[model samples]
Target: MRKPVLTIFYQFNPWHSTIGGVQTVVSNFIKYAPDEFEVRLVGTSNDPAQPNGKWQEAELAGRKLQFMPLFTLQNDNFRSLVPTTLKYTAALIGHCFASDFMHFHRLEPSLATLHWSGDKTLFIHNDIQKQMQSQENANAILWRRFPQAYFQLESLLVKQFNQILSCNSESVKLYQQKYPTIADRVAFIKNTVDSQTFCPLSLEEQQEKRVALTQKLELPANTQFILFAGRLHPQKDPLLLVRAISALTDLNVHLLIAGDGELATDVRLEVERLGLSKRITMLGSVIQAELTKLHQATNVFVLSSAYEGLPLVVLEALACGTPVVTTNCGEISKLLPANCGVICEERTPVAVADALRQVLLHAENYPIEACVRATEPYSASTVVGAVYSDMWHRWKQQNLVSTVQKCSTNFT
Candidate 1:
């Protein structure tokens, strides 16, 4: 028999949304969910044009999707916290009633709601409180609303869930470290990728595309190509990448940074200041297909982010058989095996540039098989299966029947 359906509720900010790891995981689950499970998406709207409304179901990527436009408080400042959170809480209340199983990505509605009913599964990507606690005072208010309310609320919500899914072992450990009593509740399932669609391009194809890209971007033939794809934000630290490139004077390398954000202008300014305009090509916001081409064309893929929760780009780059240069963040050690990439000790321009030069100079010495194999367990189907397995195991332990009607629901 097919397992019962599970409804995932999230307030998706679509317009500013990039195809990052979390979104990719959700999409991948929808694509290859178990036969016994019916996946329903309930996303909150970010449309300023239409704010006051309830959640509605629709089709996203040919899957059943539900989007709700709730009254949201736009600014992260103090005044809007309570009202905006209440709005989100109301939407979640509606979602809770509709869903057989509720999986929450964000803390807003979950924190606000009094009742924690049904087979609940909480997905905590990062320690939001821990992250916020470290931030400046201005940002701290956005982190904790109803500080007194949350005092008991977090404990209540944590106990209410049948299981809690974390992105990596590191995250799981963090949760265990904080809440040792609920150690059994926390589980780890790393993010996945679409292997068939995201696999490496042929050498000839890569070279051909590289030639076209070189001509289109006016890139020099002698210059070694290095790719940095992601948002140009403080979180991403793209300017640091420019500074890194600037420091790499000995190497004839050209950096192709793809993506734009709040730090876009700042990154450009840094490029100018360092006189790295010739060495760096800021190809702002290229689509996925083009991104694949860029990954294939590049000698090494680099991620210089200050922090991350298992970035999908790193996986994508590996799937494309491209070597990587990244800062030691999150579970990157688990992701990058052997010679697939180099992990820097710190997030500095000098550190990044030194790693970049080394990787580019002897890129071929890295294990190609290791690079490709690193992404094997993280394919869309494999990842989706793992998620179902974890959920099913939890359901079985709790002696609950899967409501969906597919017979191939066994975790094995």
Candidate 2:
């Protein structure tokens, strides 16, 4: 009796470098897999130090973590996608055939290797329609029309998936409306947070962690920190968060930015340009453990993304009992409440700054209990258990293989 093989594919290397939302989701599946399943990871070696187009593997959580290295333009422009898709296909040739179920974080890999796998699940972290249009303000007509062109191709690729999951209900609705053919396949599943790992501490613990974090930043004691965690990408707009923080001229306030990507240099320059060198600290590529600490210690968490599909950072922050001030991107307005977090309808720095100021000035309003309670429905135990169990049940019903069909869906 062989356990069913499942390969969770993300687009970044969790083995070497820090990962973003999509990678983190894939990692979560790997982390909480049921004992009856043999979980595997397929990610790209996105670091510069790694060799390009090379197949690499390492052990993660007692499973094989494979890397498909591909180096292209830092911005992930259209020029790079063709070769990137081809490379992903080549890398997944063996894994696709060996695995019973293939779960993908990015569509390009699955689209290219569709013929290689029988059971395919395409998890939607970013809505392709929104992502393609996110940067449409670029100063070219071709760029404006690019989203529609990409969406047309993506529409064709999407119908090939066995399942399409998203955390954002709006994204689910959009998919159902745009492509009714695959409407039954698309469903909204809530994102999960490890409440035990990201829980709030007592007042004394918070104070102690805050003091230590402040010292680590080389800042004076008792500094009020605003934390932003996301990739330095145009969609994330770390620059917007920097600008918002710069406008908060309060001497007690400081901003800590975590994560790294293409716009890292641009964000640094924007911070310097705003004369916020002292007020802002760039904590590049902080791992999940440290990120949980940041969420616990910070006064408020913020996100200024142009678009998203219910960011994991926000859920992690809430689970840590940190109130958030976020622009109404993705499902932020729906995911956050007035007590748990502040949602800004306006996307400008001034508006975001005001939201930050309001949260900072009135921290008592967003109680730690309320913030933590908001995230109760998103507990990892419930959500992850449901995901793995649901998939297992489906696999059994479909009889992907005779051996796996006999396995019970109950957590083994």
Candidate 3:
């Protein structure tokens, strides 16, 4: 029998490098795709070699998955809008023609899935309405300024998808309220990580990693690190983290930031003004291996984001036996067990400082064993692959039943 073909389309490249949680999700979905399916992935590429207004496949000599990209996706200015839209629309339409099942990411390309007469699903990674309030990135600006238009767009788009899988449970409920007709179709599914690649180190290995961390961050060997690994944007609230660090009386506690974004300069300026230059190390964007090491090395992982949708970094850190201190965002509260997490009730510097201080003061209470346990339920291999496979099988069975019913009526 010919296996059902699964085609996934997104707006960013997830196969090559780590960009954010959305890209991470895309890569994991590809990695853990069902055994009975033939998978195809398509995303945007900014490579200069890719010709304009064309969809081209990437060189898969050493790559994990083959990819095709619409070259004009990056520059979203008025001039390139028509060509970019045409390229991705044509590419997705073509892929749909040959596909039995489809998974889509991002808003526009996902909306294009409506053009296809196949089984399709869309995954929600964030609470769009709340994220717009943050105006954290360029994309959020338009939503924030024109709230009515944003709501209309969401109401329209959510109606198109056959099923909507959301990372945050809260987001699922929110979607239910926003679109009552599609409430039954909206479901909660947690984002996952590879626990094997991000597991905790042994005591001796931990000591060595700390020593290595000291050299990498140019800090004291015995320093207790608090790591934050996300874009340095207002939504992530990196500056709030900087302020929280300044509020902390513990001189031994240091913050290691592992990303760069629009607010990078502001973060640097804030760190300098607060005289936290020595206490904070802005590592910028590091590779996944180095980030895994950072997760393994740090005393605690922290996120001061204004909003989220079950962030991957938190799971990765927990999988590496690192405790977390984050604001109540996404479905994060569910992952953190007692003493294994320090969730700030408020999004203030004082609240964050207090949580950080608590974890640093009573480090033994937050054991590596408990931290690792928190991430067990969200393993990608076990959860992501199985979920998609089951969904596709059910949809295919439904289609078969419908076809048989139509045939019986015509024959009679």
Candidate 4:
């Protein structure tokens, strides 16, 4: 039997060397994709050579990844928009002509998928337009930078995919509402964690790791550590975290933000102006091991994202048996079981601070075991299995449909 072909496309810049949720998602997919399927990953980033050509291909584990470098000219505003779109669209059309089925992973590729007539599946990680606009306050100014024609082109291209897979129910509902014609095609598949890498650490292990981490960072034990781990983008609302820390005067809570982005300097200034210089530590970026240790050490894990499909950090914190304080954005409320974590009010510093205090002070109310158990369904194997199953089922259905049509034509 011919192996079902899977093609994943995205814009990934690993050289920046910072860990974020999208990076985790792609890495996890690459990590867990089954051997039975023939996988091809195509993506672009800051790769300089052969800017308009397919740079190279590599075998990661058992899967194949093709990294194509899209050339962008300096001072050319329509490079990623028109040129990248045309190149990726050509690539997808070529893949469609060769492959039995296609699993797309980004808006850029989705545009191409729409143009190519094939068995297509799209994985929705976030509301891309909302996410783009979120960086409006930051230097991105995505809308201002990208021409209005780009949105029209993207919207036009998105309508062509045969199936859509979203990471959360909220995304599904929102997209269904936004694009009612494709409501039936939208499917729900949640993100997963690698249980082997994210399993429960022993009490002794937790204590030892936490102590070592705090010692390395020189943070005091008495200080309430509020951990925020992700890119310091405007969407993440890093300033709100600093503002929340500034609000708490009664407690010796010290905030540790473990990530980097465009707003890092602005956030640091906010921390200083609030007189929280001593209480805040911007660890910039840390490795996965250190992040796990920080999770184990932290009293509260907070995410202040303006929006999210479903955050991996929240799942990671739960796996570490740490309580979380996050906004209602993302599928957070659904992820937060009866005793998992605290859901903060929408986008307000006072509300987030108040929610943080509640979780920190009443930490006992949140059962650590339950939260850990809640994350089991999101294990990498489980989640990847879901993705594989859906793609396989769709591929079979498309084949059956084609066979039936062929038989009908023969009879006629």
- Listed in order, each prediction's TM-score against the native is 0.82, 0.85, 0.88, 0.83
Which rank order by lDDT, best down to worst? 3, 2, 4, 1
lDDT (Cα, tens digit) per residue for candidate 1, span 1-412: 3456677665544333453456556667676766566666655454567654555655545656555545543322123334444556666554344455677776566654447456777776653444434332233244344456654566666766767787656668866776888889888877777886577777788778777877877877666789988766555677778888888989878889888755677788888888888888888777777787788778899998666667788998998889999988767887887689889998788999888888888877665566788899878787778778876776675444333323346532
| TM-score, predicted candidate 3 vs. hidden true structure | 0.88
For model 2, state the Cα shift of residue 63 in Å: 6.1
- Relative to the true structure, how large is the alpha-carbon lDDT of every model? 0.70, 0.76, 0.77, 0.72
The TM-score, computed over Cα atoms with residue i paired to residue i, of candidate 4 is: 0.83
lDDT of 2 by residue, 1-412 (tens): 5677786765556555454676666666766777888776655654467675555666554546454544422333222334444566566565434367888776666655656656788888765456656662352223345566657667778888888999878778988998898899999988877776788999899999999987877888968999998777677788888888877776489998887766788888988898989899888878788889899999999998888888888999998899999888787777898998789898888999999989989999999999999889888778878988987897786675655645755436
Residue 132 in model 2: shift from native, Å? 2.1
Please state the error at residue 12 of candidate 1 in Å.
Answer: 2.1
Model 2: which ten-residue window has the lowest total lDDT?
72-81
Task: Give the clashing pairs for model 2.
Answer: none
Top of the candidates by lDDT: 3
Off by over 4 Å in 1: 1-3, 13-19, 45-98, 112-116, 127-141, 144-153, 390-412
Q: Show where candidate 4 strays beyond 4 Å.
A: 13-18, 45-98, 127-141, 144-151, 397-412
lDDT of 3 by residue, 1-412 (tens): 5667777776565534534787777777777776666666776666667654343454332224446665534433122324443457565654443367677766656555656666677788886657867645545244566678867766777677778888888778888887899899888887889875789999789889898878877777778999999877667889889999999965588889998766789899999999999898899887788899999988899999989888889999999998999998877778788768788989999999999888888889999999888888899888886777677677679779989999999999
